[model samples]
Target: MPWKNQSGGPWGSGPKGPWGSGPQPAGPRPPDLEDLLRRGQDRLQQLMPGGHLSGFGIGLVALVIIVIWLFSGVFRVQSEELGIVLRFGKYVRDAQPGLNYHLPYPIETVLLPKALRVNTTSIGMTLVEDPARGNRTIMRDVPEESLMLTGDENIVDVDFTVLWRIKPNGAADYLFNIQNPEGTVKAVAESAMREVIGHSDIQPILTGARTATEQAVQQLMQKTLDHYGSGVLIQQVQMQKVNPPSQVIEAFNDVQNAKIDYERLQNEAQTYANRVVPDAKGRAAKIVQEAEGYKQQAVAEAKGQSARFLKVYDEYVKAKNVTRERIYLETMERILGHSQKLMVDGPAGQGVVPYLPLNELTPHRQTPATTGSARQSSGVTK
Candidate 1:
């Protein structure tokens, strides 16, 4: 509302006539703005206590600005995200996803990253070789990355790749939390590999058992990392190549060839023996059968002869004396048949005998011819 002057000065100044100013208004009224402000102040002082309502108006505006600043600093974290709060230069508490508030920094600061996001720390220095041959070659080892020994009391050149990522929210914050997380992973993987390989043989690391051994190393690494409170999981351990030193490359190849050849020769010899032993056994069986037949024939002949002799002896036992005299006469005839005997007359100057089979054999035995002739000569004389 415009405040007009109470003292009338010119009603029709546009007519360009300055009337005589003998009567001036009461005393020029105070400026209207000043008059209006004085009246408002007087009205508020009469109605309010301690002038609190007037002060409330000013306080309200200031409150609104502070609230705006705080709400503006209130930010949200996603389900996969984690917030690391920092107050003045010190790390404060870790926050989870959703609407959360913190004092605006330079007062307090928050660092947010996807804690659940699986970050890969590839041990790139370690790589798998040609999978088709199961041969892996590691080009450059982060030796802080991978080194191992073999069973043959020798140092081996070994390298491998590890697949890993952060797991626990609080741990990753502090793990990347600490400066280079990648370097930590590389070092841990190498140490774990050395531990595992040192306990294993070179041949297994080089060949088929490589897969299983690597898996064991990964498990061990995961456990150790978790113990360190570095929230990382070992996803996999890829076994690259176990190589002999370049100076001994030919020796390594020769060893492989010799092993293969030895196995092949052993198999071949076993096959030959399998084939030949049965044939030899068959021949031996035939010879044993022939020997058995000869034994059986000899036994049968001896049995038949024994039976015949027993029958003859039983019949002879029945006619003792008669059989004995007949047996003696038959024996003498048979003995005389193959031998020569002679006799001479007594008139021939005391009869010198040329030979007598029975008399020559024994002086104790007199021949039947000599006894019979003496008895006959005596009978004729009587």
Candidate 2:
């Protein structure tokens, strides 16, 4: 009806053609002109042929067909991948990596996404490289979009990375659910990381909490993606450098140095205690040992002196007169003989004089037996 003339009839066939005789049958057939031409080309080649023209023609046609088929459903999935099939714009089945067949395109189509490869997302206020960043000169500086805030209302520079991979099934179709997956992941990571960072201090973020932050971001990203029904599996989150904004970098650096000094002082005190405590113990032990040795030596010496004095005292108790006479004579002798007068007559001659006390010149006037008895009584028997 669309190809018909506006008169609602075939062009000039109203009276003689389809409407006239309902279409007439052919009376005679045409000659085999195509067959004759084919025979002529074959005979010409047989006489002086340059190359396999027929084979080349056949190969060209076959090549075109092969190319069409190759681009049609001949999808090549990696060893770890799977192909998702769609029929009439609807999901049909999943195919593995290898030679596979499907109904030609428009009827049954194939969609593929790397099922084993990891995907990544990023978040933060710290400047990073981006394809969309302006000219090379501008890109050399911070990317303003990456800056974010902490819960304490402090602007901190934080950079991070996310690692993920598409789930095995329906990944190809899942891609259609989002316009820009990278951007979505970035926003979610930034939100989650910022929320966590806000609850922490700048020092922990810089030095200690990198691992926790990375894991938290990874989990948060996974949760967000799951909430959005995005079939993505998070592998890891890498927490990069976290620093104070450029305006306060110097202050933060000074704070770091102060902490180092604090630690240094603490270590010095510890070292002093460590050295002094052991030395004090050793000195205390040495003093105690010396005191113990002195105690033993003094006790032994006192014992010997006491024994000798007891022996002498016992002897004096037995012969009191003899001991008294001997002690008096020895004392007098030593006192009288302490200094002798020396008279000098001339330079070549000297004389000594005895300086004794001549108070008692009387000897004992008694019998010999009585004298012996008296000497014996006075302990002078020997």
Candidate 3:
């Protein structure tokens, strides 16, 4: 009735209807339910042999769909992956690599986690996209993560990387126990590194203890993750850099160089001592040996002289007069053997002359020149 009126339907008969404008142009109408039903029935009839859907045809169609749905449960697992099966959202069992099967969706499901793939997590640095540089990624240091306190109350900047992977036998725990595997690994790595650094000195950390720190951090992280059943296997921990804070780096380097110089000087002194001490000891030993030899020679000579004097005393005690007379004659012979002299038998009464020219009688007393000079001097004196 309103449509027949044509006065903007329910609104008043005027150019303005309802709120303001008059009636608008008719738009596209909604689809008719009866027409849609008739079309669907026609399509079904065309698909069926008797121009109508039968009970057997419906059953056969459902059977084919069910078969396809059942086959949809099949999945292929990669070689590096470990498949975990869940029933009714509960973990049921594990599946190995290759083709595997489980109940269809809403009943059972499979999760393929790469158990053998190595995952790397950096502790103190982040890669950020640089818009100014053509969207390239650049490493940005995080001071909060990199700076830590040492055992000696010193601060050190440390950057390290952790290599990890899902445990093969613990894939279920990896997925169920830990919500975010990589995040959990990163947090654990940072915590472990901080703990290790806290117990170490800054000097060794910046120098030769990098490998040791890495090993300690890895072991500690693995132990912690195991305690929580995180199902993470830590493969390796690598230290990217370890150094004193930038503010004190120059001073630290100077101190290290001084320490090196000190050690070098100590080594040189030790080497010199090693060389000189042996030579000094050898010279002292040689001097002592020479003194000992001289002492022995003196003692031997004194003993020989005393033994000879004792033998002579014993001979004197046995024959006093003869020994004395022989000693007197020997002393006189020794005293006058080289003298120029003549002996008288008696005082000017025997056949011996009182004075004799002993010097002239000796052939070896004077030469011809000496004799001529002597005669000339005698003549001159006469």
Say which candidate scores most in lDDT. Answer: 3
Regions more than 4 Å wrong, model 1: 1-68, 76-80, 86-100, 106-108, 122-147, 176-179, 312-382
> Scored by Cα lDDT, where does model 2 land?
0.62
lDDT of 2 by residue, 1-382 (tens): 2112112232222111112212222112122334544555565466545834576555554565556544555555666566665554455688788766666544555544566777765554333455565532221324364455666676778767788777667464344454455667677777877777778766667777788877877787788888886677778888655777778889878988999999999999999999999999999999999999999999999999999778867878999888778768978889966433333444453465545656434554679998678656543122
Ranking by TM-score: 3, 1, 2
Candidate 3 per-residue C-alpha lDDT over 1-382 given as tens digits, one digit per residue, 9 for 90 to 100:
2122123432232211112223322112223335544555666678988787787765665565567557767877788888776565567888888888877654655666777899999978999999999999999888899999999999998888999998869887776666567878889999999999999988788778888898999899999999989889999999998888889999989998999999999999999999999999999999999999999999999999999889878999999998899889999999977654444444576666455677666777678998779656552111
Query: What TM-score against the true fold does each predicted structure earn?
Result: 0.55, 0.55, 0.68
Model 2 ranges off by over 4 Å: 1-83, 95-109, 114-118, 125-134, 137-156, 170-173, 176-180, 195-201, 223-228, 322-350, 353-382
Q: Can you give the lDDT of residue 255 in candidate 1?
A: 89
Q: How does model 1 fare in lDDT?
A: 0.61
Worst 10 residues of 3 by lDDT: 12-21
RMSD of 3: 16.9
Please give the lDDT score at residue 326 for candidate 2. 73
Judging by lDDT, tell me the better candidate of 1 and 3.
Answer: 3
On residues 232-303, what C-alpha lDDT tens digit does candidate 1 reach at each position? 767788766577665677888898899999999999999999999999999999999999999999999999
